[model samples]
Every structure is written in structure tokens, then in C-alpha cells.
Target: MTEKQFKKLKYYVIAITILFVVGFLLWEHLNGGILSHHLMHHSDYPSISNWWGLLILPFLAWLSTVRIEKRVTLQPDDAPVKAKILRVVLIGFFGMLVLSLVQSLSFSVGYESVAICLSLGLVVVGLFLPIYRAECIFGYVFGSIFFTGAIIPLIGILVIAGISWFSHVCIKPLVFRVIRAQPQ
Candidate 1:
């Protein structure tokens, strides 16, 4: 990818990540700091919001993958994403299931922090799956889930924003430098 493209992708990732972090904070605060209380208490069937979140996972994966593809100049063969939509959906489903289980366990165990840690584990799974399996959607969706369980949503959002900034401003250029220094 050209330097220009890399810069553009970096900016886009930073902006989108910040937006997500802020949006999650607002949603949690407005809803009394619980992300899926409706699912936990009000409804047996998953709501439209739940399905909507799931549906968007593939699109988010596509966005992040496309950015990485261009930034790193990956050959089509270097990273193949087959059955892209289906894979993202299934992984997202698993993350959701884990999230639900953790939530339920939290109620029984009376420890919300433990549930949050498990939920963050789901996000880590989502993030790494994209790196190895060439599926990216899980990261965003699971990230939402991770932030959902945050004891202090504002702090979580700030941390996420900071990570985005650090990755884009510091890590991105360092990676390019490393790649340039390597012998072809």
C-alpha cells in the first residue's frame, strides 16, 4: 500500500474506534450502565438490537480487514478470508454465548468483575481470531461486549481511545520502518 493509503486507513481506524468507545459509554450511561439488561431480565428472545449488533459484525470485520490489506500490502494469497460472512457470524455467536454465560454466572456468583474479565476474554478471542483466521468482525462486536461489562464505562472508553491513538500514531509508523529495514 502507498503511504497515503496507510495514513488514510490509520485515520479511519482511529476515528471509528473512538466513535465506538464514546458511543458505548453513552449507551451504558443512558441505560443505567447495563448493556443487555433487557436480554438478562426483560426478554427470552433476543431483541432487534441484539440481532442488529450481530449483523454488523461482518461489516466491521470487512472494514478492518480491508484496511489491513491495504496498509500492509498483503497479497490476496497471504490472507484468504473464505466464507467470510458465515465465519464471522459463527464466531460472533460463540462470543455472544460466552458473554451470556458470563452474565448469568455473575448473577449467581455475585461478582461483576469476574464476569467482566470473562467478557474481555471473549474480546481477546475476537481480536486474535481476525489476526490468524482473517476474520475481523468479531473484534468490534466483542469489543462492544467487553466495554459493556466495564465497571466504569467512561474510563474504558478513554482507554480504548488512547490505544487507538497509540496504535495509529506510534505503532503504525514503527511497523513501516521495520518492514522497510528488512531485506527483500
Candidate 2:
């Protein structure tokens, strides 16, 4: 996309994010405050309001869009790869949204195992695709914000990002050096 188009897209995303926050606030107000779970239980800590999303979501949106624009500008020729990444991000966003909805709405089903599996899967993906940190975090928090709230997912992503960075910056080079040192 051209710079002009990216600017327009950024505006649209900002507008939508604002609308979403307003809608969520209204919904929460209408049906009492939305309570956030701590460590997968509502009673483990004092009731935390979902109002945190109002600030966090917009920040994530801005950060992700800026990162995406920079990536597109730096490698304009990688349009196909960029498109694939976009598709994957969108899929992940919606998939997480659905999962969060289900886990929040249903009290009978055990989804802890599923969540653990998905988290592990994302860690593996992040090790290989460390360049999409902003996109991954944005998609994850945006998708799960309604049910999981903002802070928990933000903390989780920060930990994952750190591990991914360590693997990419430290371990990968060490492994490459070891491989090169071995006689064929």
C-alpha cells in the first residue's frame, strides 16, 4: 500500500478502535462493570474493571499500525509476504476472539488445556517469526480484551516477546556458530 493509503487506513483503524471502546464501556455500564479475572478466577483479586482496555487497545492499535507501516515502507517489494502475514494476523485475531468468547460465556467446558496449547503454539511461532512482535501482540490483546482484559494479556505477551528476542538474538547465533565449527 502507498503511504497515502496507509495513512487513511490508520485513521480508519483509530476510528474503529474508539467506537469499540465506547461500545464496550456502554455495555459494561448497562450490565454492571465487566470484571476481569486474575489467574483465571474472579475472586483471586479485587474486581478489576475492563476500563483498562480503553487505554490499552488504542495504544496497541497505534503501535501496531506504525510498525506495519514501517515494515511496508522498508520492504515494499515483499508485498506477497506482507499479505500472508496480514492474513495470518487477522485469522489469529478472530480465532482468539472466538475462543475468549466461548471461555467467558460457558462455565461448564474446560478450556484451560486449550489455552495452554495455544500459548505454547504461539511461543513456537514467535521464535520463528520474531519480526511480527507488534502485530502479534496487537492481534492477541485486541482479540481477547473483552473477556481476558488488557493487562493480563499484555504481561503475557511481554514475557513471550522477551523469550523470543533472547532466542533470536542470542541462541540462534550460538547455534549457527556451533554448526559452522563442526567438520563436515
Candidate 3:
């Protein structure tokens, strides 16, 4: 590559790295206060065994956004769309199932488990799926848009939900087909 191209690439990579680093620092600082209260504070650092738990949130965020710039290109036109879609769906479904159970146990009286599962399913699916803008759309929004007549009568809400589901579910089949077409 030319020197100019190399320089530009370096600049962009550096900028992105710095952004993630600062984000990590900010997240860590906030989580530090919460952890200090729940686990141990800077004052209690001497008394605590390991205060590193405070870093977990920032670590997660860092992990999530490591290559955020490339999330779109993470999967390509030539990629295995079906497998990718299936994986995302399965994972999203499981997460939704758990979220449903939690919601049920919290609000309802006797049908806690059932309610929880249903609630979790809806919420988790919304969360796992991302829209064109890469936003997570939860069940309340999902059901409202896609299953409008059935449950979600609000079009605005359903629109966002549909986008999220579409993002998650839409690409998989395409990827799968492309992969299958490749010569062995």
C-alpha cells in the first residue's frame, strides 16, 4: 500500500482504539463506584481480596465493540447466510425464553414460571435482534409491529421491532445459501 493509505489506515485504527479505550475507562469508572459499594471501594481496596470485578463491565463493552466498525461487513454476501441466521435465531430464542421467565416471576401471581418464560422470550428476542441502525428491538416493540392484529396494534412500535427481527433473521438464509453454493 502507498504511504498515504497506510497513514490513513493507521489514523483510523488509532482513533477507533482510543474511542473504545475511553469508553472502557468511563464504564469502568461508573462500575467501580457500584462495585465498591457492593464489593469494595478504593478506600476498601486494602481490605478487599480482589477489586477487579469493577472492570467487568468495561471489559464486556470492549469485547462487544472491539471491531464495531466492521460489524456490518462481519458477514459478507459470500458468507453462509443460513447457518448464521440459524445461530442468531437459536441464541436469540434462548435468551428470549429466559427473559420471559424473569418477567413472569416478577409481575404475575401464581403463573410465575409461565409468565416469566413468555416475557423473557419476547424481550430477549427483541434485544438480540438489531435494526438497520444496529439497535436492539425488544418484544414489546417486536410484537407491536409484526404481529399487530394479533397483539401489537401500535404500528410505530411494531416498525422498530420488525426492523430488529429482520436484521437478525433476514441475513442468515442468504448466508447459508451462498455457503452451500461454494464448490468443494
Give the candidate number with the greatest TM-score: 2
The regions of model 2 sitting more than 4 angstroms off are: 39-44, 76-108
| lDDT-superior candidate, 2 or 3 | 2
Count of clashing pairs, candidate 3: 23
Tell me the tens digit of each residue's lDDT in model 3 across 80-148.
663564356445434533443344334335654675466445445454545312112222222222111
Task: Give the range where candidate 3 is weakest over 10 consecutive residues by summed lDDT.
Answer: 144-153
- Tell me the TM-score of each prediction against the true structure: 0.31, 0.79, 0.25
Candidate 1 has a TM-score of 0.31
Q: Per-residue lDDT tens digits of candidate 1, residues 1-184?
A: 4558656765675567556656665775687653542434347754333324433544444555565545345434333353354356456445544555555457546886786676466445433333222222234244444433322222333444355456656767899999999999
- Ranking according to lDDT, highest score first: 2, 1, 3
Model 3's TM-score against the true structure: 0.25
For residue 7, model 2's alpha carbon misses the true position, in angstroms, by 0.9
| Top lDDT prediction, candidate number | 2
Residues 38-58, candidate 2: write the lDDT tens digits. 655657677556788889888
Give each model's whole-structure lDDT. 0.48, 0.72, 0.39
